[model samples]
Target: MRSVLVTGASGGIGAAVAHRFAAAGDRVAVHFVSNRAGAESTLRALPAEGHALVSGDLGDPEGARQIVDAAAAELGTIDVLVCNAGVAPSEENRHVIGDVSYEEWTSTFRRMVDVNLLGSANLAWAVASRLIERGAPGAIVNIGSRGAFRGEPEHPAYAASKAGLHALGQSLAVALAPHGITVTSVAPGFVATPRQEPKLDGPAGDALRAQSPFGRVGTAEEVAAAVFWLASPEAAWCSGSILDANGASHLRS
Candidate 1:
């Protein structure tokens, strides 16, 4: 069985992705930033044995390193890395260029960029190094967002950060291909996770659903399925691809 490490695996898309691998008989390291209980729940939900829970703040470089190190230590060797830890736009961190204060704008941008882009980059370095050292074939699947291409007026930083992640995967895809390591990304639209249930049931629900021709937003499981395939050896040739899981919400020519 493959050893997989899924960051932010405490809930939502991360949890789903972790479950997907675990169900496939792979040992998974469910990494979380703070939600230890959630991580434990995810671990318990896995289908088989040898699954583990790892926690570290991706915002800190040392924490990021510790996260990867902890996962490798637990799993023996990680064959797949799912970079899914990231902060989403919330009422507190919302920064509209003209609506929010300068301090708020700067702070929001800084935090999002640090965790979403740099954090993923550091984790990738640690995991890719291990794969290269062992001379093993593996894959990395980054959880990006449709906001990267569709734009996020109230959360420009989130959009830019995700866009950078997509670009990072492409660059790494080429660099790591020689080592039998594939890298790809997934851009998902609004996903109906527990945290998003309010928005989905509130007054804004209709507009959100109308974003796609399907008359519904996406789901964490849907994204997980795509990530599952991307992380498999069968999809090795799909390296560098930025697969869309937006349900036609935002089309890119």
Candidate 2:
């Protein structure tokens, strides 16, 4: 079985991704930052044994390295690295241009970019390095967002970071292909995770649903499925591509 490392596997899409891999008989290292209980729960819910739980702050470069190293050590070797941890757009970190102070804008941007972009970059580097050293073929799938293509006015940092992540995946796809590694990214839009329940049940619910012609938001499992396929051997030729799981909510020309 291939060893998989899924960051932010405490819940939502990350948890679903872990479950997906485990269901396929792959050993998974479920990684979390602040949600130990949730991470444990995810580990317990896995269909198979040999899964492990790891924790670290993705915002810290050294912490990112430790996370990958821990996962690699636990799972024997990390053949698949899913960079799913990210700082989502929330009220506490909201910084609209005109409404927020310069400090808020800069701090918010730094925090988002550090965790969302640089964190993934660090993990990719760590995982790819090991695979190269061992001469093993591997896959790295990054969980990006449709906001990268559409826009996130209230959370411009989030958009920029995801855009950078998509670019990073493409660059790595080219750079790592010679080493028998594949890199790809998935851009999901408006997934209905527990954290987003309030937004879905609030007044903005209808508007959010209407964003897609299907008249509904996405599910964590759906996103996970896309991630799963992208990391599979059948999709090796799809490296450097960004698959959109937005249900037509947003399209790119």
Candidate 3:
């Protein structure tokens, strides 16, 4: 079985991805920042054994490296790296240009960029370096967002950071391909995760669902499925691609 490391696996898309890999008989390293209980829940729900729990603050560059190193040590070697850890947009970090103070705007941008883009970049470097040294083929799947393309008016930092993440994956795909390692990313839109349930259950629910022709928001499992496939050997040729899991909610020209 392949050894996989899925960051932010405490819940939502990360947890789903962890389940998908484990269900395929692969060993998984479930990484969490502060939600050990949720991470344990995800670990216990896995179908197979050998799954482990790892924790670190992705905002710190060193923490990102530690997380990858710990996961690799636990799992023997990381065959797949799923960069799913990131700071999502919320009321606390909202920084609309005209509405928020200059301090809030700059701080929000820094935090989001640190975790969403730089953290993922550092993890990729750590994982890919090991794979190269061992002469092993591997895959890296980044969890991006449709907001990168569709625009997050109030959460511009999130959108910009994800956009950078997608670009980073593409660059790494080219750089790592010669080493037999593939990299790709997934951009999802309006997923109805537990954290987003309130939004989906509120008055804006209909508007969110109507973004896609399916008349429903995406699911964590669906996003996980895309990530799973993109990390498989069969999809190696699809490296550098940014798969849209938005159900045609926002088409890019």
Q: State the lDDT of candidate 2 residue by residue for 15-115, as single tens digits.
A: 99999999999999999999999999999999979999999999999999999899988989999999999999998888898999999899999999999
Worst 10 residues of 3 by lDDT: 89-98
Q: Roughly what TM-score does model 1 have, to 2 decimal places?
A: 0.99
Write candidate 1's Cα lDDT for 1-253 as tens digits: 9999999998899999999998899999999988898889988999979998899989899999999899999989889999999988898888987898899889888999999999999999999999999999999999999999989998899999999999999999999999999999999999999889999999999999999999999999999999999998889989999999999988999
Considering only N, C-alpha and C atoms within 3 Å, which residue pairs clash in candidate 1?
none
Q: Deviation in angstroms for 208 in model 1?
A: 0.9
Q: Please write out the lDDT profile of model 3 over residues 1-110, one tens digit for every residue.
A: 99999999999999999999999999999999999999999999999699899999999999999998999889999999999999999998989988999988899999
For residue 221, give model 2's deviation from the true position in Å. 0.5
TM-score of every prediction relative to native: 0.99, 0.99, 0.99
Q: What residue runs in model 3 are displaced by over 4 Å at the alpha carbon?
A: none
Over 4 Å off in model 1, which ranges?
A: none
